[model samples]
Target: MGTTPQAGGTVAEPITLSTGETVSVPLSTEATVYGAIFSADRPAVDDLLPRGLEPIRATPRRAAVTVLAVEYHRIGDEVMTPYDEFSVMFPAVEAGERSWPFASLATHGASGYVWYLPVTTEPAKALGVDVWGYPKEVAEIDHDDHVAGRRTTVTADGQEVITLDVEAPPAVDQRQEGVSYTVKDGTLLREQLTLDGRLGAWPYSGQATWELGDHPRADRLRDLDLGERALARLRFDGEFVIGAGEPVGTV
Candidate 1:
């Protein structure tokens, strides 16, 4: 069997998925990301997590809510169509553990529970749900970049779900690793992601703006009681690699 070479000088063996599609392991992508981190009510955040997880409070009463829009320019070494994706995640930890505040954002061992994930392509949505157990749906995700900044909008069923506007800031070279927790068939799935790129971060200061529409998904986020302004806004342009997810425990 021929081996497929990947980034980092490693070779990935091809495997056929349950969907009858064949792809290389450890998916890689080149994307431009726009993100905003908001502070939400801790109890409200916890209400949305699975049984085995608890919200990671950024403060005694506040939890972190993250919204990200990724514009994928390439996937793996094969020629594929580009797609846009938007996600909502909450910083969380396994139950029965001491929850760390803001430190959870940068520290290892913490996981982000994906609450809503929408992609523009069927293949992307199918792969995410079938492999990683990500809560993915096919939606209209539009990513627009301009000389000034970027704007991303997500719509479903002819109704707008959410829209985020981010201002461009100067970036610095950085690398980050993150873990994500998802649920499939009542089992908790853990996936690791590594990113290498130039990161641009800005403190809230009323610089970032987001609006929720009448869609039910938007209403769910509205119920979270997120802070009036974002805690931080970020932009990253670089390489992203997602490892296969494995079952960690029952959800």
Candidate 2:
């Protein structure tokens, strides 16, 4: 393991990856996220990726799409205050693990890649873009919790990017957890997350729509040629937390 200089002359813990590589990462931020997931066939979108970042197929070419709204309660950066994030992601696992989604129902440790990450503050954008290499930008985001579940929207310069509505039904106590992947410092990193609250979530078929706006980055969704029909929709109105990302390996 290698060390990265931390604040106050202390060294941050070096994370070990499955391939025996190591890297230092930001470990201070802890958040509770409220989110939903949808899936669809996005062939055009799959072509733009580099090696080892291919979409995990649910069917032949259908991929999972996740829409998330996050709340950061504990963090090291206060300037990124009012820490809220609106994220869209897909499961892009190892090249050979293209069948990852098949095991999603049986395992919770699968990882994916972030398709789009837009936060509410400038400092947050800096960390996301500069440090994490995520395509995060500053945008106007709003949240509403109603009887159905949660509704989240993203807008910039008065133009809407996307809108999400989900429902968390009543049921027995339950929990769902998973990990998302990111490439940081030339090493693959896995972000651990868990959702615990309302267990009975309504599963609906084909529910997400994307209005890719004029924002250069936001509008990139056009390349995906995403079909009008979503694959599935999952509702979650529970407590979710993300742990410090762990190093896994290179792509």
Candidate 3:
């Protein structure tokens, strides 16, 4: 059994799932990702967060929303059939914390609240929810590569949810560390994340487009008043590590 390290200078024991499967701590994966950050109405974003959390404003009156799709190729040291995922996230900080806006992203000072997560496999959904309280549902996620870039589509319950198209560009090596927040059983949880990869980004020059569908799940996002175009688009290819979640406070 591999021992995993926690953020608070302790080692985490493997978790035994309800399905009788054991998951090691500090989950690691190799994946290809495409993501974007969009501007949204601050008040609307605030309404979506749980208590004790506030939106990190990208601009006065405008918060930020992140949408990303990932294709996981391996887990731990084992290579497995790939699984796809699509996620919607809100950049936020704890209530009463100073908001640094754009600087927060560069410095990893803000926590990401996952609003929605759809995955292609049952294990992915189960592990996400059971381990970290990630709000995950099994869905159909399709990825296609074209000359211009890549297109990802998410469908759930026979209805389309969202589609994202991103252009490929030159990437530079980068490493990032951040925290993510989730709520489970009335408790707020925090997980540490680390990523090393080649990252490509483009400012809002029409390099990407995100479209929401008529699905009810999509309506939840529509309420945010997401901008017509993303503030920036990103692509990353490399490895990611997720630490065990620790409860921070009651929700």
| Clash totals, every prediction | 0, 0, 0
TM-score of model 2 relative to the true fold?
Answer: 0.69
lDDT of 2 at 175: 68
Candidate 1 matches the true fold with a TM-score of 0.91
Q: All candidates' TM-scores?
A: 0.91, 0.69, 0.91
User: lDDT per model, in order?
Assistant: 0.81, 0.58, 0.81
- Span of ten consecutive residues with least summed lDDT in model 2: 102-111
Error of 3 at 125 (Å): 0.7
Off by over 4 Å in 2: 1-34, 72-80, 98-111, 126-131, 206-212, 237-239, 248-251
